[model samples]
Target: MSNIQAMIVNVRVDNLEASLPLYKELAGDVEVMRFPYEDMNLALVGPFLLISGPHEKHISQHATILVESLPLVVDALAKAGAEIVDEPSEVPNGTRLVARHPDGAVFEYLQPRA
Candidate 1:
């Protein structure tokens, strides 16, 4: 069985300037890592990952799970009736796959390259 190494709860916001301070306050002393990718500013606040940008279409909250094996996890999710929204793609830190469960829950799965 593929194990989950890390789990991240993603929160999408319209105004980064307005939302950042709230997350900063909620996370307390945890350092937030700012990652700029595809015109989106992602703030990693402990277990909470905040994504904010100008794109209105991509403004929705989701979850990400770092799995040991991307292919294995994808296969398992597929068996459970999760439709793959985005194929595995190379990101800055690793490969990412997006899928939507039958219950309409969306999730992103990551397999970091060693």
Candidate 2:
């Protein structure tokens, strides 16, 4: 079904050190992912993901969906009236595209590098 793989709900926090402990308590023994594009850190705690970084106008809390095929999904989404916010670009371990659906919901789609 649409080749959707995994979904990560990203939460933007003001301080990483302050919030990390709480998340660690909730989801013990988890690994954290660091992003180079921005001063951001991500931790997968249970079914939730915590993304902490400085408060910036361009950075907002959003959900990321991993897909099998980026171009296919992008084309389909565009046909469905989704406004592409960021074009497909290389990230740390994959390519990411940001878009907003017609319902005013924004999401980031990721396709891991092959």
Candidate 3:
């Protein structure tokens, strides 16, 4: 039997070029690397996605996108209609923020900046 392991993640973006900076800024140069796909005509980055081209029913189905900065992410997503699963608050000695995607997928944006 083949071992089942979770690998890779993708997000469909209406404009890949525009979203690149966000991921770049979020995950500095060292954290991410990009590959060009001309024949396929797509730019594939690391686990952080920057897919451009089209958005259809098949894409954007069920996904919970998480960002690194909890407080910043929560405020930003809330402005974009992300349902507040929980506010950005401290827990024990750390902190975390939670939110839900439109499709009901829950995401916890964590920042342990250690």
**Number of colliding residue pairs in each model:** 0, 0, 0
Best by lDDT: 1
| Residue 69 lDDT (model 1) | 88
Off by over 4 Å in 1: 59-61
Better of 2 and 3 by TM-score: 2
Q: Which runs in model 2 stand beyond 4 Å of their true positions?
A: 39-47, 59-61
Estimated TM-score for each candidate: 0.83, 0.81, 0.36
Query: Candidate 2 lDDT, tens digit per residue, 1-114?
Result: 768988887766677667777877776777755454566676566546677655564535368888999989888897999988888898887999899888888888889888
Model 3 / residue 18 / CA error / Å = 46
For 1-114, candidate 3 gives per-residue lDDT tens digits of 312122234665677678777767765663444544322224434455455553442223233233445556666676878887666675432365567766676664546434
- TM accuracy, model 1: 0.83
Clashes of 2: 0
Task: List lDDT for all candidates, in order.
Answer: 0.82, 0.76, 0.52
Best by TM-score: 1
What lDDT tens digits, residue by residue, belong to model 1 across residues 1-114? 537998998887777778878888887989878888787888888888888776675524378898888988888887998888888999987999888888888889999888
Worst 10 residues of 1 by lDDT: 53-62
Model 2 vs. true fold: TM:
0.81
Number of residue pairs clashing in candidate 3, backbone atoms closer than 3 angstroms, sequence gap of 3 or more or interchain: 0
Candidate 2 local Cα displacement, residue 66, angstroms: 1.1
